[model samples]
Target: MKQKRDGGVAVTGTADKQPNAQLTSWFVRSGWSKGELARQVNRRARQLGAHHVSTDTSRVRRWLDGEQPREPIPRILSELFSERFGCVVPVEDLGLRSAQQPPSGGDIDLPWAGPQTVQLINEFSRSDLMLGRRGFLGASLALSAGPALLEPMQRWLVPTAAAPRPAAAQGPGAGGGRAARLSEQELQLLESTAAMFREWDSQCGGGLRRKAVVGQLHEVTDLLQEPHPEPVARRLYRVTADLAALAGWMSYDVGLQPIAQKYLVLALHAAKEAGDRPLGAFVLSSMSRQMIHLERPDDALELIHLAQYGSRDSAGAATQSMLYALEARAYANMGQVNKCHRAVRMAEDTFCDVRAGEEPAWIDFFTEAELHAENAHSYRDLAYVAGRSPTYASLAQPEMLQAVEGFRRDDVHQRAYALNLVGMGTVQLLMRDPAQAAHYTDQAMAVAKRVRSERVNTRIRKTTHAAVRDFGDVPEVIALAERLSEELPEVAEPA
Candidate 1:
C-alpha cells in the first residue's frame, strides 16, 4: 500500500532524530504547547486551501526531533509562526532538512579575480539568459550563505590583479571573436541601454525584461573576451557591471536566487575591472539585500558592513546613505531596535547632506523617497518582530505613508509604488486600522496589475495572511484577504 497523499501532500517518513534547535527556538517563542501547535497547523491548513491535512502532537514532537514534514506542513508552520509573531518567519528559518538544501558544499563561491569574473558572467549570464523564470535554486544548488557568500568580498576589496589582459581568452559563452575595438559612442550606447533596463526593471518586474537584460550582459562578456584600449575597456566593463547588477537585482525581484548571486559577483568583478569601487560596493549591497530577503540578517549585515567600509573613500554621500539605509534594514530584521534607529538616523543625516550631482549616475535613485522607503521597511520589520510594541508600529505608519506618497508621485516607480502600498497596508493592519489597511491593499492590488514583480506579490501574500490571521473578524480585512487569496499564487521561497 502507498502512503496517503493528504490534499496533494505526499506523506513522507522521518529520516533523522536529532534535536532541531531552530525550530525549538521558534516554538519556545510561540508560547504554545505541542498539542496547541498541532491544532493551529491543522486550522491554518484549511485557510491555505488544504482543508483536509491533519497533524497531531506526535507530529509536532517529530518536527521537534528534526523530522521534515512534507509540503503544505512546512509552509503551514511557517505561516503560523509569521502570523503568531507578526513577521515573516521563512520556512528555511525552521532549520528543517529538506531536499532543497542539497549537500553542504553546493554553495556558489565564485572566484573574485577580475578576469575570472568576466568568464563567470559569460557562462552564468548565458545560462541565466536561457532561464525563463529559472525558479529559485533548483536541483544541485542551494542559496549560498555564511562564509561562502562573504568570502568573495575579500578578494573584491583587495584584488591582487583586478583586470589584466595580455592575451584575450573567453569562456564558451563568448562566441569566437577577434580582439575587439569599441568606440566611446558604442560605450555610451551600452550605458544608456543599461540605464533603460534599470528603468524597466523598476517600473515593471524582472520577469518581463530579464531575458533581454541578461542577453545584453552576455554580449558585453563577449566583448570582454578581447582587449580594447584601456579607456574603452574600462567603459565596457562599467557597462557590463551595470547590466550584471541590474540583471541580478531583477532576478531577485522575481524570486531567482542562486543565479542572482553569480550575476552579482560578476557585477562586482566588472565594477572592479572598471576601477569603480563605488560600483563594487553597490553590487555588494545588492547582495546584502538578497540576504535580507532570505531572512539571513547576519549575512546581510556582514555584506552591508563590507560594502560600507570598502567604498568609504570613493562613495559619495548619496551612496553612503543607501548603504546606511540597508544597514538599518539588516539590524531591523534582527529585531535590534536601538541599532536600527541609530542606523536609520545615520542614513537620514547622510541623505540630508548629499549635494546634487555629486554622486554617480547610478546613485540618482537614492533620493529622499528611496531612503525613506528603506527606513519604512526597517520600522515595519521592527514593528512586526517587536510583537505588539506599538512604538515601532507608530513609527512605521508615518514613514511608510511617506514612502507610498513619494512613489505615487513618480510614474516610473510603478513597482515601488505597488510595493509601498503593500507595506503601508501592512503597517495599517499593525496599527489596528483594518479599513485603512484594506484600502491600501486594494490600491496595491490595482497598481500591481500593471507591475510584474514577485517581490510585490510576496509582500501582498504576507500582508493578506497577516490580515486574515489577525483581523479575520473585520469585514474589510476578510474581503481583502479573500481577494488576495484568489488572485495571488502560493508564496514559495528558496526553502
Candidate 2:
C-alpha cells in the first residue's frame, strides 16, 4: 500500500511520517557501530538500575528513527557517546537541540536585519528562562548566523540621532513636580533592584542570575518606550538605563564579552535620555572594567578618560576615587608600573578629599579597605604581567591582610572580601609559599560554600589549583584540594 516517494524513496501513510535519515547519519558520524552503541546504552541503563534492559537492535533503531529516549536514557546516551569519543557530544547531535530554531525574519514578517522589538523581547524572555536552570552554560548558545544579528539590535537600542528634549521641558516649571515624584519612585526601584542583585551576586554568582536581570531590563526598556507623561517617562528611562548597565556588568562577569559590549552601548543611550550625565559617565567607567578584563588596557584608559570628561563637573570625590582605582588596575594589567602607581596615588588623594558625610549613597561601597584591596589586586595583576617586582611583593601582604579583615564583617560585602582572600592566596602561591597559599585559599573556599556564588567558586578553584600544583605533596594542601574537588560535581569539573 506504500507509494513511491520523490528521490526514489518509499513513503509511508504521510510524507511527514518517514524516518529521519539525518538522525541515522549523525549516529554513523559519531563513530559508534550500531551494535556497539546499543550495547553500551543498555549497559548504562542497567547501571542506572532500569528494571528491564532492551537488547533488541530494532528498539534502538526506532530511537534513531526519531523516537525520543525515555528518562535518564538521554543523559546515559550522552555519557556513553562522550566517553567513547573523548569529548562533549551535544544533545543537538542526537537530534534533540531544541524543538525548533528561533523564527526567521521571513516567517515573522520582520526586517531581514533588525529583530522586531517584540521578537527581541521574546528572545530575552527565553534566554532568561533557559539561563536560570542550574548548570546551564551559555558557551554553546550560538545563534545560527553567529553574533551579527545582535549588532543591529544593539544599534537600534542606541539611537545615533540627537536626543530630543522631553515635551515636559516646555511646560511651566518644566514639569518639576511630576519629575520629582517620578525620580523618587525610580530611585526606590533602583535601590531595591540593586540590593537584590548585590545579594544574589554575593550568594549565587552573577553568572547564574544575570540573565534574569537582563530579561527584567528588556521589560523595563519596553515600558520606557511606552507613551507616558514626559517627566515620569524620562525618570523611568534613566532608572532602566542604570539597570541595563548593571546587566551588562553581570554579562561581563560571566565572560560573555560580545553581549556585554552591546548592552553597554544600549545603556549609554538610556542614560543620556534621562540627562543623567554622571550616571552615564559611571556606565562608561564600568565599560572600562570590561575592557580591562579583555586585556585592552589602552582602550580601558581611553574609556576612563571619556568617563572623566563626561562627568567632570558632576562626579564627587568617592566617584573620582573609583574611576581612578579602576584606571590603575588597567594600567597595571598593561605593565605600565609607574602609571599604575600614579593612578593609585590619585585615587588615594581623591578619597582623602571626601569630607565626612559628603559621600553619595551610590559610592558608599568603596571604603578605605576596599581601596587598598583594589590597589593590592592591581599590584597582583601587574606582577603577573611584568614578573614579580620588589614593589609588588611589599604591597601584596599588608593590603591583602587588611582586605581579609574588612571582609569578615557580617554583610553582603563578605563576597568581595572572600574574593580578595583568594586573590591574596594567588599572590602567596606566586611567592612560592604553598602552605600560606592553601591557608588563604581554604578560607576563601569556606566562604564560597556558604555563598552560592559561581564567580567566587571559580576564583577560589583557580587559586587552589595553583597551590596544589606548587605543593601537591604537602599534606594540608592536599587535603584542602581533595575537599574542594569533592564539592564540585564529578561530571562538571572545576574550571
Candidate 3:
C-alpha cells in the first residue's frame, strides 16, 4: 500500500490492501529469506529489551500482505533494515510508524567480556607451540577427569569476573608486527586457508597434515595480539576460532584427548571474543562430543545442556536440530532408550522445520546424511543394550542402511563414510545376515585403510572384535575377520 498521505504522497496503508512492495524490495536486497528475516526481527526485539516478539514466518507474511504490525515491530524492522542495508531505513521506507525511542539492551552479566580472551588464547597457543615443538603431547595423556572439567564448564555457563583488559603489546606478534598491517588480501587468504583446511580434514581424515594445521594456528594466534580495523578484527577472530575448533577435532580424531581439550577451550574462547554465540555453542557441542567418545555420557549430557541453555532464545532451527541430535547421542550412550528416542524425535522434527536459508554457513554439514547417521548410532546403542533384540535391530536397519548409502555418495567425508560402513556392517551382523555383514565389513575395512584417523581405526577394531565374539559361527563372519587381520596386521589403537 505505499500510498502517499500528506501533500498527496504515497505510503503503505495499515489495511490489508495491495502487497507491501516497498518492504519486500529492501529485505530481498538484503538476501534474507522470510524465516531468516523473522529470526532477525525476534533477535533484534530481544536486544531492544523486549521479550521474544512472538514473530515468525507467518507474522512476516502478514506484514508483507500490507498489514502493519503493532508498535515495536515497525520500530524494530526499521532499525534492523537500516543496519542490514548499511543505509538509513526510516519508517517511511517501509511505510511503518517508528516514532518512538528504541530500548537499550541490557548489560552483559557474564564475566570476561570483550577481548579478554586474547590474553588467554596467546598464552595457551604459545604453550602449545613450545610443548608441541618438543613432541611433548605427541603421545596421549589422561583426558580431563570429569570433576576437573567442571570448572571450565561453570565459567562458560556463569562467568563471575568482570571484563579484563587485553594483555600488553610486548607479547609475540603484538605492538604492530605482522598482524598490525593486515590487508584485505591477507585476511581473505586466511579465510580461504581455514576453509581449505576443513576440506582437507574432510577428504583425508584428521591424522594427516595435523602438524601443518597446528603450525598455521600458532602463527595466526600471534596475529591476534595485534589490533586491526573493527571489521578485520572480527573476521580474524572468527577465522581463528574456526581453525582452533578444526584443530581440536583433528586432535580428537587422532586420539590425543587432552590436546583436543586445549584446542577446544581455545576455540571456545576465540568464539566468545568474536561474539559469535552460534560458534560458541558449536564448540561446546564439540566438547560434549569428546566426552561422549570417552564414555562419560553424564558429562556429555551436561555439556550439551549448557550449549542448549545458552543459545535457546536465538539459535536457528538447524543448530537446535543438531543440539538435540547430540543430546540424543548422549542419551544413547547412557542407555536411556526412552530419553534417547525422545531426543531423536525432537531432532527429526526440528530438522524438518529448517528452512533452506535459515541455517548459517557452518551448519551446511548437518544435513540429512548427518542426521540419519546420528539416528543409526542412537538405535544401534539401544539395540546393543537390549542384547541385540530384533525389535531395536529392525528399527536401526533402515537408518543404518540409509546413512551408509548417503555417506557413500559423499565420498569427500572419508572418515564418516568409512565409519558408517563399519556401523552398517555391524548392524547387519546383529540381524544374522552373515553374507551381507561380511560384504559391508570387507568394504568398510577397505575404505578405512585409506583414512588416517585413529578414532576410525579404533571403532573398526571394535567392530572386528564384535564379529568374532558374537557372529563367529557364521562362515562369512570368519572370512571378514581374516580379511581384517590381513589388512591391519599388528595395528594398535592410538596412544
lDDT of 2 by residue, 412-466 (tens): 6666777888988888876777788888888888777665555577677767777
Q: Count clashes in each candidate, considering only residues at least 3 apart in sequence or on different chains.
A: 0, 3, 6
User: C-alpha displacement of 58 in model 3, angstroms?
Assistant: 75
Which 10-residue window in model 1 sums to the lowest lDDT? 132-141
- lDDT string, candidate 1, 372-426, tens digits: 8899989989987888567888898888878888988898878888988998888
TM-score of model 2 relative to the true fold? 0.65
Best TM-score among the predictions, by candidate number = 1
Score every model by TM-score. Answer: 0.78, 0.65, 0.70
Candidate 3 minimal-lDDT segment of 10 residues:
102-111
Candidate 3, TM-score vs. the true structure? 0.70
For all predictions, the C-alpha RMSD in Å is: 7.0, 10.2, 23.3
Q: Flag clash pairs in model 1.
A: none
